[model samples]
Structure formats: C-alpha cells, structure tokens
Target: MNDIGTILGNEQFARKQASFGPGGNVVPIPRAKKNRQPPHSDTDRANVLPLPSTNIPHRTQSGLIPAHVRVLLIQKNTEDRHACRNALQQTSDFNVELVEAGNGGEGLHLACQDAFDCILLDCSLPDMDCLEFLGRLTELTSGLQLPLLKLVPPHKPELAIEAVRRGIHEFLIKDEDGHYLKLLPVLIQRMLDNRRLAHEKQQIETLYRTLIEHIPAITYIASLQISHQWLYVSPQIESMGYDRETWLSNPDLRFQCILEQDRTMVERAFAKSCETGELFHCEYRALGRHGKLHWFVDEARIIRNHSGQAMFFQGVIRDITDLKSMRDELETHRYFLDQHVQSRTEQLEKRIVILESCNTELCNQLEREYLVCNELRKANNLQATMLQAIGAAGVTVEESFIHPET
Candidate 1:
C-alpha cells in the first residue's frame, strides 16, 4: 500500500487517481506553493464534497490522547476522518481525543451526549449536509460554548462568511492534495487556546459566587435613602436580622435591626459620610433575628460621580461584639483603680497631719521640765552655803563656852 492508503487505508485514491509507476500507486504530492482552488461551484451549497468512503467504524479508537484537549470530527469520508484524528494526536502540546461520526446525524447525537473542547465539521456529510448540521449545532451551543472549526471547499467564500456570522470560530479552506492535514493541528490548537481562556473566565465567575456565599462579613450596596434601603446584600446578611431578599426588598426592615440607642450614633456617621463622600466607620449594636444583640463595625464609603452627587453606598460590617465587651470591661476596671488610689491617698494625708501635731506638743513639754530642774538646783546650792556658815558660827560660840565650835 502507498503512503496515502497507509494514512487512512483509502483504496479509492488508488483506482480513481493516477500515480507515478506502472503499478499505479497514488503518489503523495509535494506541498503546493499554494493549494489549488476548487472548481467553480455555488458558495452557498453544502460544506462537504463527496470523496472516498462512507464506511464509519462502530467506534474507531486510538491510544489515549491528552485529557486536556478533546475534538469531535464529523466526516463521512474514511480518509479525511482518520487523517484528522492522526494529525491531532501528533500535536506536541495537546493530548487530543478524536471521536468520529459517519454523518451529520451521528455527529449531532454524540455532541448532545457529551462536551468537547471543540467541534471540527466537514462541509459535506452523507445523512445530513454540512449547512444543516452547522445551523442545528450552533443552535445547540447558542452561547458559543463549543468553538466550531469548519473545513470548507476552497472557493466557497459566501458560505464561509455565513458560518462565521453564525458564530463558527474560523472556516479553513479544504485542499484536494490533503495539505489541510498539516494545517488541521494548528487550527485545532488555536481553538483550544480560545476554549481554555473561556473556561478560565467561567472559573473566575464561579469563584466569585462561592466567596459571596461563604464570606465572614456582610457586604452590601445600598442607596442613600431615608429608610437606609439596601440594593444588594451578601449571604452573611442573614446573621443580622434578615435574609438577603428580606433586607433588600423590605427597606424598613434593616433599620429595625438597629437598636433605639444606637440609631443616633449610626445615623450621624452614615449621614456625614454620605454628605462628604468619605469612608465611613462606626460601631453600633444590632438586634439579630435570633433575639440577640450584637456589636458590629459598620465600615463603608459613599460612591459618588464627578459632580459629587452620591451614587450609592458600598460597605462591609464585621461582628465586633466580643471586642466591644472587652473594651467595656477594661474601662470599668480603670475607673475602679482610680477610685481605690484616691481613697488611699486621702487616708495617708490625714495620718501625716496627726503625727505633726504630736511632735510639736512633745517639744514644748521637754523645755518646761528643763526650766523646773534648773530652779531646784539653784535652791539646793543656797541651802548648803547657809548651813556651812551657821555651823562655823555655832562652833565659835560653843568653843568660848566649852568647845561648842566643833
């Protein structure tokens, strides 16, 4: 068998077309400077042309291609269908999965059953023609979910444009010498790149949705109305007195969550921020649906236009009931310490005054006792002098009358 027959086991090319030798084998043509254009045909006609065989296998399978890339090939010709499968598997970057269909009807059946990275359609099919298949398939993937790459006849410019308008990714012209086989890998690679980008976009959107549902704080968008109406509320709003729907739809309900004592404080800060278009922050108490009062930090900003008109309010509120409880407990402790210190200081001042008075009285009593002792000493000295003098005089008298002086 020749290389063409080996590529797809195609025997029609051997009988219908001529090759080089007397044995009559089909020669693989060189890559043409430019692929030959199709003979004059209606551009609006079907996309596929009758070529070789209609014998599609029950399920033609190959070694597993990469799980990352999957392609669906709907071609009736055995040669073209297998040719696409082989080229896609050989791609260096993609692990390509190629599912074949005998006709457009079979292709549609497989497409609806499962999802793929892309769809490759031959303009012609045996059961359903290419145009009908494309129209119906486009309707199936209306949101341009699955990218379509069509293999069209070389000169069908009109049909190609229509296919694009219907949201086909690109229409690559077909060649008779099988040159499109080399281009097929590249086209599918482009389609896969686009598909990956779109897949990432969807993932990001899903992530945002999940975060909105499970976040720890309440996020909201509200209009600056007298009722403090909410426009949008996150899932966490359920912790506050309302569900998301009730908070947004019932404007008066949100205000009801604010305690009567906190209404003035919250209103002042919120109103000031709205008027100034500044970021707002406040701590207030709220009544939860569970009949519990909780503290929250209301932080938000007034979104405004260039003209300084308030457009809306966007903000987050974190539950701070634990923090508030701690703060109040600390303040109470501080006040108690101040009172205790003041009482101790006053007691010490009173004791110091009593001690100073006792010290002054003790000094005065010691001075008077010293003065009394001095007077007694002076009187004793005078008596001793008088007695000595009297004894001497008596002695002189006694001596004259019988030694009495002794």
Candidate 2:
C-alpha cells in the first residue's frame, strides 16, 4: 500500500458503511472525532452534524454528462490515477468520466474510438515519447477535439516546453509531496473551465466568419497608418481579381489601382474622417486585375478608443460601374426628349400665328363689301325720291318709271 493508505489505516479512519434504501443510498458519515463529548445545546448539535441544504452550490449527485465534456485521463502511475479519481469525487456538479491507459499506444487507441472533451496525457509514457504521441494525437483528433494537456515530472521543465510546442494545452508537474494531491481539485477545475472557454471562443469565431462570408458586398479592414496596411480582407477577395495573401502583402499595388484623379480626394476624406473620428464615404475609380477601369463606392468609419482617437478603419467597397453607366444613359435620353419637345412646341406656335393673320385679312374684305352695299342702297333711295318729284310736276311719267326700272 502507499504512504496515504498507511496513514489512513494508522488513524483508524474506517470506510463508513452506507445502506441502500428504496429511494437510493445515503452518504456515509465520517468517523467521529476522538475525545469529543456530545453537544448539549441545540446549536452545538446542529454544528456537529450539519444537514444537507438546498442552498448548497454542488448537487448531491453528479449532473448528466454533457455531450462535449467526455474527459480522458491517461496516467501510468497508480497514485496519480487515485488522486484524479478522488478529485473528481469531490466535484459533484460536473460529470467527468475517466479512461485509463498504461501507454501512449493504448491512449491513442481509446482516443480514436471515441470523442473527448479534453485529454490528460503524461509526457513520459512507456510506448512512445510525448512529442511523437502528440503528433499522432493531432492527426487522430484533427478537427475533432480542442486540445490536450501534458503531464510531466517536476524535475523536467524542458519536457513541458517541448510538449507545449507540440500543441499541448498546458503542462502539469507531478509533486512528490502530499500537497500535490490537494491541488488536484483546483487543477481539474481549471482544465474544465479552459475547455469550456475554448469551445465558446471557437463557436463565436465560426459565427463571425459565416456572417462576413455571406454579405453581398466586399468588406475589409485597413489600418490608418501612412503605409495603409490591409488588416483584414473578406473572402470575396478572389472575385475582386486578387487573392487574399497577395493583397495583404502588397499595399503599394492596391494604391496604384486607385484612380490618379480621385486619389487626392480619397486621401483628404480619409484624413479628415480619421482625425475627426467620423464616417467617410467616397466614390472613385479603380483598375481591376485586367486593367479595366471600374467605378467603386467605398464607405468606411473610424473605429475609436474611449479617448476618441481613431484606431483603424473598417469599410466595404462595391463595384458601381454598371450603375453609373445606366445613370448616364438615362440622363442622355432625358436630354434628347426635352430638346425634341421644345422644337415641336416652337413649330406649333409659328403655325398658329400664320393662321391668325389669314383670319384677320378675311374679316377686312367682308367689312369693305358691307360698306359698298350700304352706299348703293342710299343712292337708290335718293334717285327714287327725285323721280317721284318729277312725276308730281307733270313730266313724262312712263319714261321716268322705265328709266328708274332700267
């Protein structure tokens, strides 16, 4: 037996017996303290054996095992195995199952067979070195698990460093003293917490990547330094006629693609926006990969600190060449239509003036004919009066009447 077992035996700390009733089994009571008399006061008795309360942080029974948190513990030492088991027993909140393996080969076998939340590996296993085992672990759990922690001896710090380079999560050293056993609980808790955090971080990153990918427009982030580095380019870079890595490496090339006429305007707007920490929007022409000129609309805003200083700019660029072309065509058609309508209106006005002059001439001719007719009627009346007077003076009446009739 180990030194821990020997000490427990000497202290007469018996494994308390428990009874299994219909409801379930009750927790075994710890051995009574020697030289301690029973308490007389109610408060003292309550303190001696505290009843389990609903307010306790941990449950009496372990919770259901989560699909993501199946732990595999691969330790060759029997003492380490027992320490881990005891630590898990203390943790009643989380359900963690252990898979023991004596060597790296057996560990790899188990890892391949099932998914795991975290892998606890010893650096000095019998079958293989830690580095080789880690390489194999990486291959086996590629796109499967998060990461694995390396178990090392207290004396070998170099082994921990090498294991970390091989993509281990963290290194744990075995302590010779009994204090190591006490620390096992805290270590296990930290490991579980780190695993959960890593999984959450990965999920958030994936969601962000998906969101950026589905956006219809091109999106990117650029630094505001004099050189203007491309901090992040969206996955749409390929459709932009440039690969992501090529654009990231070459800032001068990107600048060269900007139209010479609008480059100054772009720079001025960017500088003002950055200084004032305001949104900047501009339209400019860009040269595509095939040397074809395209109109591009860029909209960006300054990302600022609490003190209101610009840190960087994130923006999107859209190819507006087709839109601009359509707008120009519409404007041209509108101008031609306006000119045609004005010409037709002027011609109609001239024709109306000529028709009005013709109507005035016809009215003048009709007025002259009416005056002549009136004059003739007046002359005939005067002549008739003269003839009637002559007839009354006894002149030849028949000749005068015939002359009047002629």
Q: Pick the candidate with the highest lDDT.
A: 1
TM-score of each predicted structure versus truth: 0.54, 0.73
Candidate 2: where are CA atoms >4 Å away? Answer: 1-68, 143-145, 182-189, 305-309, 373-406
What does the lDDT read for residue 14 in candidate 1?
Answer: 14
Model 2 per-residue lDDT at 128: 83
- What lDDT score belongs to each candidate, Candidate 1 first? 0.68, 0.65
lDDT by residue (161-222, candidate 2, tens digit) is 88777667656665554344433434555555555555566666667767876786677778
Candidate 2, residue 319: how far the Cα is off, in Å: 2.2
- What is the lDDT for 182 in model 2? 37
> Over the stretch 346-390, how does candidate 1's per-residue lDDT look in tens digits?
998888888878878887888888888888888899999999999
